[model samples]
Target: LPWHTTGKLSTNRVTSSCSRRAMPELLQFKDASSMRKYSRLQRQAGKRIALVPTMGYLHAGHMSLVQAATDRADIVIASIYVNPTQFSRNEDFGVYPKAREEDHRKLLAAGCAAVFEPASLYHPGTVSSDGAGDNANVVGAGEHVVGAHETFIQVEQLQKGLCGVSRPHFFRGVATIVAKLFNIVEPDVAVFGKKDYQQWRVICRMVRDLDFDVEVVGVATGREEDGMAMSSRNALLTPDNRQRAVCISQALKWAEEQISHREATPSGIQHEVTDRISTGGGRVDYVSVTDAENLQELKHFVSGQEVLVAVAAFFGSVRLIDNVVSVKQAG
Candidate 1:
């Protein structure tokens, strides 16, 4: 039911107009050999472009970012690559959603100027640290071999806790791919969703530290009426488990209330949140309070350092995460 548009349109009607736009033509690339072929078209268009990268299986959360990109730039290019490098052997990489044809239709329907539905590994002209190609393994030349690890970027410190703690290699893989995307897309601005608050913070810090000319903008997380954040993985939820997913967001709200009412200390808040979710039959991943800026745990809250309560839980095979932060939270 949620709809939005990119570029200039009446605030009330952007989504509708975006829908009216034609379904985007697919820009498929076999490998890094094709990056030039695609970027060339972007350059020829002579318009500022924006990038919104995601794992595909588009939902309103991603659409929100795409629409924001369209609002800021003349063109929007969304990448739906589920980079294999980013996932560990035991992670959700195997189960990650891949709705290729459907996603292409969604991207076109979202009013994006181009869809970088790269076929597989993109050379980016940057070889892996091990001096091998990333796509070599996936391409399967018939002899049976694993491809090389292309050069990937890593951002330190900022990724210590939050989602980073659970997914050890997550930010490193994210930074690497994001860096690759920036280099490849070369957009004037890029969009990221604020739902994965830690991911946004990591990318922002990377852009600043790396001195990437592109601007990084964050769109708010899109939510269901029940307050569950929209995610493709949400489809994996059972009807009953789907209802518990809302508890992640609800517990976040309850924590916000605790802080707003000043009733729970950081420890008290953590305890209460974990108790609430666990009692509700949710498998708590990690619940903690931290300094909003540095992501360091707070034994107690300071006057205004900004505090965030973040949680991740398993709902069947899907892991749902939700966070609540102080009004002026730092990071």
Candidate 2:
């Protein structure tokens, strides 16, 4: 296959034609069975495998995850499937953006061992009206596709708050699809972004409780020059909305400052963040301060308890989420 040379190397990193040899060949897989076959072969040969799950439309944030996988395993498999189960009906699932060509280029440039672009995995039967057609030969990644499968994985209590408040069914979709990926890929390790802090904790809990042998790694969130966490949805932001979106990170920074200064209580910090984001011309979804480990809602600041201050808001049509977590210590 043709490799992508268009991706620019980040500052402090050297790029040259010879460096490409250090990167593995970018193989493409369109179904679980084929990808699993390769995984089985790798396991038999005593090679370690690392998996990075993602919806297509790769960015620098995704490349960071891929890089983490490469550092840990002999082979890196990145799955690009836009799971319909994770998106609510009113959410923008249909138009979430699928740049397979560009994503392929980026993955190739990032030295991914294989790209699993399954049509649909969980939905096995004919396609449902959710846009997945009935003609799919095998089970693939398609929304609204009819399938006999009804089993879903959920991390009780954890999914009840935070981003889950607005999108109730979102985590169910995420947990179920992720379980499926872990089963099919059977990776020795998996990497996820901490931008979705709650989701990361949820996956970590699920892995531990389910007894999956795979190691779950949380890579730090990747941000743009302006401090906005990079996401596929960033493309949906209009020019002015994009500028206004910077307030999300700004509010986070302000909350961090308040924590450092010991000037604001948990609720006060939450209200201040809500006000700042709202005053910045964005609609607030939820501004919360909770225990980072258990996500229990915090009433007042408690020393030694790790607290997570997370925010989700709408900048125009785009819903943005960011968080800051730290151990509360006595000043």
Candidate 3:
């Protein structure tokens, strides 16, 4: 394995296997400049690169993204930076679960070619410490300082509803960091899990509108056997809260069913989902029925048009989100 930290590169050997062939050593890069240079070299060699950007708590959901990227390109680079800009002042950035060595092991086993683990994309010359806990002082949405990163990217219309309504600063941070990754990695394609439906749509719209020459691929959301969507925050759930969290997926499925049968209005479905989650011991953040493509909240269902039923709820302080898309059929 090769680890690039503070613009210095060190190599180590790791044995791994992939479906295509015996995998090469896993490489790690901690700085933007080194990764950019490596990406340029790969591009010059006529290799197709795919990027799977993650926050570094590797779970099955993230590995699915890596597999999706591996299937598409010759080289797969997974970036494991827990973006500080995305977190709000009161958010869980400080306590965000991090397992760097374990994450590296999983990516190595999944046959990822390289890991871009930049410490501070916004602050030049800032190096990452061993864990996310040490980087607690990294600036977030409103915590700007003199000579700190001030620029942010926002997809105006798409980021207005759903999760945006609650975590207003979130999508801007996501869009900005992702744009920086697209520029740094310059991958031929990028993979994102569709669990965050609004975020996926936001990134797609950003790529299209900004004219970034990268293909954005959305993989289906990975779920647990009990129907709960996989998330890093799931680790924070108490035993009781974990059980309660399943209602999010259950509500989404019920909403999808209602849409398919045309048995309820969009508002009716939203209210029902919210009530179900609340009854299940979770605090309802929002339940929205919106146009799947544009994310405009829908008041009436249109046959043959896809609408998304998305929800975000708090299960004992751990917020979980899940969504489902369905199209009504003409009678």
Candidate 4:
């Protein structure tokens, strides 16, 4: 159940299993019920498989995850499900960018072996429904309820900082859907982007704590030439907002420079960074410094513990988040 692999797996069981008369053939499934069949096959072969989960509208960030899988796995399966639970009612769940057909083409281009794009597979409750998983009144259950109704994965202390403060249920929704996807897909490894630094860390912890038989790998955030991190939501930005939204990344860069030089305290770094984002005519939502892995608010920066500088802001009506983690610099 340890997150870190010894890389020297016990092959006795593996050898015995392969020696069985008939190992199940590998197959991919899209819906939740079909997952059992795939799970059975994976258990039979003990072969490596990987999953890359995304909301669709593939960008370099996603493609990077796919390529990472190709490097680490014998088979790569990407699931494109715009997780409805991950979105708040007012948070553009209905209109979040989805390009299923385009995503299929992109995954194909990226050399992914297969993709499971589940559509409208969730239970819809009422507007008054509390965001609890136990809500009894299942009003209109979508065809993909198994895909939709996930037992939420909550990693304690990891969700204490960052956008979790404002978007209270965001990570809960994320954790639930991701836990389900992780369970349904049952990949040997799963990939996530470092751009969502907190989410990535939370998921990493969830994998370790829940004893999920999956390795969580984080690919560095893919970015534009001008240094802004790429996001599918970037498409929503108007030209002027797009130009000014660079302030978020720019601020994070400036803060990272200060931290590297020992020139700024966390508070000072955050204030200056938030001010910079705001000065660019964007409305700052939150700018925080936290323990890099756990996303806990930082009281002091210790030598071994990494630091995370994260910010979210509104560029026009669209809210965007960008962050920098204290990754070791190349020599």
Best by TM-score: 3
lDDT of each: 0.72, 0.81, 0.84, 0.72
Better of 1 and 3 by TM-score: 3
Clashing pairs in 3: 1-12, 1-13
Clashes of each: 6, 7, 2, 1
Q: For model 4, how does the per-residue alpha-carbon lDDT over 1-331 read when each residue is reduced to its tens digit? A: 1111132321111111333584322223456755544544555666588889888888888999999998998767788777765665567555578776667667766766556666544554333334544222122223323334445556667776688887776777778778888777788889999999889988888888888988999999999988999999998889999999998888999888766655456778788998999998899989998777667677656654577899999998788988987742332
Candidate 1: pairs in clash:
7-70, 7-71, 24-108, 32-123, 128-150, 128-151
- Model 4, stretches more than 4 Å misplaced? 1-29, 42-46, 121-151, 327-331
User: Model 1 over residues 95-188: C-alpha lDDT tens digits?
Assistant: 7877876776666677775566555554434333343343333322223233434466777898888777778777887888888888877888
TM-score on alpha carbons, each prediction:
0.81, 0.88, 0.90, 0.81
The C-alpha stretches of model 1 lying farther than 4 A from their native spots are 1-45, 122-147, 328-331
Error of 4 at 95 (Å): 1.6
Minimal lDDT window, size 10, model 4: 7-16
Q: Judged by lDDT, which candidate is best?
A: 3
For model 3, give the 10-residue run with minimal summed lDDT.
1-10
- The candidate, 2 or 4, that scores higher on TM-score is 2
The all-Cα superposition gives candidate 1 an RMSD in Å to the true structure of 7.4
